[model samples]
Target chain A: MIQRRHALTVRVTHWINAVALILLLMSGLQIFNAHPSLYWGPSSYTGAGPIFELAGGFPSWLTIPGTQWLAMGRRWHFFFAWILVINGLAYLIFSIATHHVTRDLAPTRSDWRSIGRSIADHLRLRHPQGEAATRYNVLQKLSYIAVIFVLLPLMVLTGWSMSPRLDSVWPGWVDIFGGRQSARTLHFVIAWLLVLFFFIHVFEVIVTGFWNNLRSMITGRYRIEHEQR
Target chain B: MASGGVLLSACDAASRNPHVTKVLSIGEFLSQHVQHAVTSRTALAQEFTEADLSPEFRSNGTDYPDSAEYRALAMNGFVDWRLRVDGLVERPVELSLDQLRAMRSRTQITRHDCVEGWSAIGKWTGTPLSEVLALVHPLADARYVMFYSADPMDDWGTRYYESIDMEDAYHPQTILAYALNDATLPIPNGAPLRLRLERQLGYKMAKYLMHIELVDSFARIHGGKGGYWEDEGYEWYAGI
Candidate 1:
C-alpha cells in the first residue's frame, strides 16, 4: 500500500538543496581552479610549498561557466551559497520543530547495537525489503544525522572563516580552524566527502527501486511492499 | 512581452556577459547588503602578534614599478618621490616619505588574505589614512578614496589603481604603510608606501602608491570601475 512519506516542506527543501548543492559544487570547482592549491598554516605563496596542489585546471564541462573565468565563478559560488545556507537553515529549524529528527533520524540503543550487522549487510549488498524498506535503516539514520548536523555546520563555519569581513567580526574562527588556509583545506576535503556521500546515496537509490524511491521524494507517496513471512 | 522588452533594454554587452550577468548582479547586491547589515562599518580586521608573523610574507602583484620615472625615484631611495593627495579636497597636499613618517604613525600586525587562496601575517607601520584625509579635508561630496600606484598593469601604461568607500577609507585600520616587519618597506613589497586595507582582499591594498584622489564617483577613472582588477571583472567590493 502506498502512503504519504515525505512532507511537502521536505520535498520542496530537498529539491532546492539539490539544485543549490550542484551549483555550489560546480562553481566551487571553478573557484578552486584559480589557485588549485591548499595549505595548512597562515601563509602560502610561490616559495612556500602547498600541502596539496592540483596539477591543472578542471575541465570546462566540470565548472560552472565551462571556462576559466574566476570572477564569474565567484559570482556563481556566492549566489548559490546564499541559497544553500538559507534553505539549509530553514530545513534544519523546521525538521527539529516537527520532531522529524527524533522520530526518524535519531539512532536508538538497539539501532546502535545493529550497526555492525548493518555494515556487514551493506557490504554483502543485502538491502532491506518489504516492510523494512518503508522506514529508514540505522545506517541511513546515522549518515543523515552526521551530514545534517556535523558536516553541513562545518562547511558553513569554514566558509564564513574565509570571509575577511566575517573574520573582522569573529577573529577567533580563523584561529579555531588553525588558519585561513587550513580552513580552506578542510573545506575542500569535506566537500569531497560530501561528493562521495552523494554518489553512494544515488547508488543506494538505484539499487533499491530507483523510480519508487525518487517518486517518493518527489510526490511524498511511497509504496510499502508486503512480504509473506 | 513587455517584461522581455525591458530585459532586452537593460542588457549591455560591454558591462557584463549576458549569460551570467543576471546572477552576478544578484550575488553582488546580496553580498553588499548582507555584509553591510551584519558587520559594523568600523569593525577592525583581525590583528596578529609578532610571534604569529609568517617568516616570509610573499608579495603578490607588481613588486616594483617598471616606469623609468619610478625607477629614477627608487634609485635615489624615493627621497624625490612625493605622494600627491588631490581631487575633491579642500586643500591638496604632496607628502614625502619623510613627512609621512613625521606624522602620527600606527603599527599593527595583520593577516593579508589574497584572492588566490593564500594568507600571510606581517607587521605594518604607517600613518593612518584618516590623518592624511584630515590634512587635506575631503569634500563632503567625496564618496570614494581612489589610490593610484606607479606600477603599469598593462602595456598601455595604465597604472594599477584601487578605491574604497569613504567609510572604509576612514576606518581606524586603514593606513599608508611605509614600514613592514619592523624595517623599511622592501622594493619587492611596495617600497616607500602602500595602502593597507586589512578588511578587504590583498588586491584591494594597492602597492607602490603614488597618488590619493578623493572623488565623488569613480566613473571618470581608468576603466571607470575604481580598480585595475575591478575593471577586468573583479568585484569592486572585495570584502570576501
Candidate 2:
C-alpha cells in the first residue's frame, strides 16, 4: 500500500488558484451590486441593494460624503480584476506547460465507473480502495477534470457574455444563451458554484486528514503504510 | 480563478489590430454593441435613488485638458464654451450651457461599465441626445455622429480625439451629461459637458465637450475608427 503525494508544482498551482479565486469573488460581488437582481427576474427591478453598509445601516467609517454605492464598487472591482487575471493566467499556463492538467487531473474512460465506486467508498457505503488502482482513485480525477474543463471554462465564457461585443459580433451567442441579461444572471450562478467548490474541497481535505494532505502537498512526499498480505 | 478566466475571454474577444480594421467591423462591432432597440427610437431609462450610486468613481484617461483652448474655457467657468453641432445638420447650431440647460431633460439611472471589467450605477441628468440631434436635424447622408472632446491626448505632436456611431448616439440612455448626483458636473468628472452612454463602457463616454460632427461614414475621421481605444486594441462598440 505505497502512497504517493502531490508534487511541488501542483502544490504551488493549487495555492495560487485558491488565492486568485478568493480575490476575484470578493471584488466580483462588489461589481454585481451595480445591478443586483438576476436578469430573468421581474423587469420592474434593476440596480438595487447596498454593496457595503455600516453594522447599524449607518455611515460612520470612511464615507465619501456624497458618492453613490455603485461608483465605489466600480473602483474596487476594476482594480482587483487586474490582480485576479495576471495571477490566474500564470497558474493556468504553468499547469498546462508542466502537463499537470493533462496528465494528473484529466479522467480516463474507465473513470466513469470508478468515480461512482469511489464516491460509495468515500461515503462509507463500501470499504476503502481494494489496493488495485494506481494514482488518483477515480473520484479525484473526476472532480479535477470537471473543475478544470467544465466549470472554469463555463465561468470564462459566461463572464464574456456581459461584454458589449456580445450584441454586435455574436448576436447568435446572445440568442443561444437566451439573452445578454440572462448571460449576466448565469455568470452570477456559476460564480456561486466556484465558491461552493472551494469550501467543499477544503472541508473534504480536512475531514480526510488535514495534516497529511497539507504536508504531502507542501513537501511533495508522503510515507507509505504497506500492510503485508 | 473564475474571474481570471472571465478577463481572459474578454481580452480575447476584444483583441484586434487597429490598423487593418480601420473601423470596427460591423459584425465584430455589433457582437458587443448593446442592442438597445432594433428600431431607431431614442429614450431615457428610469432615474436612480441616491443610495444606489457608488461612493468613488475613479477618473480614467485624461482628467483635464492641457490644450490652451480648453484651459481658457475652463478658466472662464465654461460659460463661453460653445458645443458646435455642425456637419450634416439643418440648423448647424452652436449651443451654450445655459441653452442646453433650458432644453427638455431626461434623467436616467444606468450602469456605467468600464472596459477594465468594473461597473457602477449612477443617476445622470441631461438632455436626451436625440433632443439635441433634433435641433441639428441630421441630414439624409448622416449615418454617424462624431463627438469631439477638448481632452487632448497629444499623440506625438497631434492631439488625441474620439467618435461614436449613430446607434449609440441615439440610445435612450445616451445623454450629454451636465449634472451628477443633482449637482453641477465636477471638473474631474468632465464638467460643463461629458457623455453618459449607459450601455457602453466608461471609455466611450468622452468628456470635455467641444463639437458634435454628423458624418456619412467614419473614413475621413482621425484613425478612421471610432474611439481612441478603438485606434488601439479595444473594440469600438464596447456595449455591456
For all the predictions, what are the DockQ values?
A: 0.32, 0.07
Q: Cα RMSD (Å) per model?
A: 4.8, 11.7
Model 2 ranges with Cα > 4 A deviation: A1-117, A120-161, A164-229, B1-30, B33-47, B155-157
Isolated chain A TM-score, each model: 0.96, 0.71
Tens digits of lDDT, candidate 1, A1-229: 9978888888999899877777788778888898898988665642557888888967656676666778777877887888888899899888999998898889888889999999999888888887778778999998888888988889888987888888888665687988788899999999888888899999988888899999999999898877868
lDDT of 2 by residue, B34-131 (tens): 24433223433333456556665556667787788888888899999989999988899999999999998877665565654444556678987889
> In order, what lDDT does every prediction score?
0.85, 0.62
TM-score of chain B of 1: 0.92
Provide all candidates' interface root-mean-square deviations.
5.9, 12.6
Tens digits of lDDT, candidate 2, A1-229: 3356676656776776676565456546545543344544111123443222223222212111112243333333333344445555776787789887777667767767577677878787343322332266577667777777777777666665565433334333544554444566677777888878778778767776567667777776654544457
Off by over 4 Å in 1: A45-48, B1-16
lDDT, model 2, position A143: 72
lDDT of 1 by residue, B1-240 (tens): 464334323322312666666665577677777888888988888887887788887888788889998999999999999999999999999999999999999999988888877788899999999999999999899999999999998899999999999989889999999999999999888988999998889999999999999999999887998899998878888877
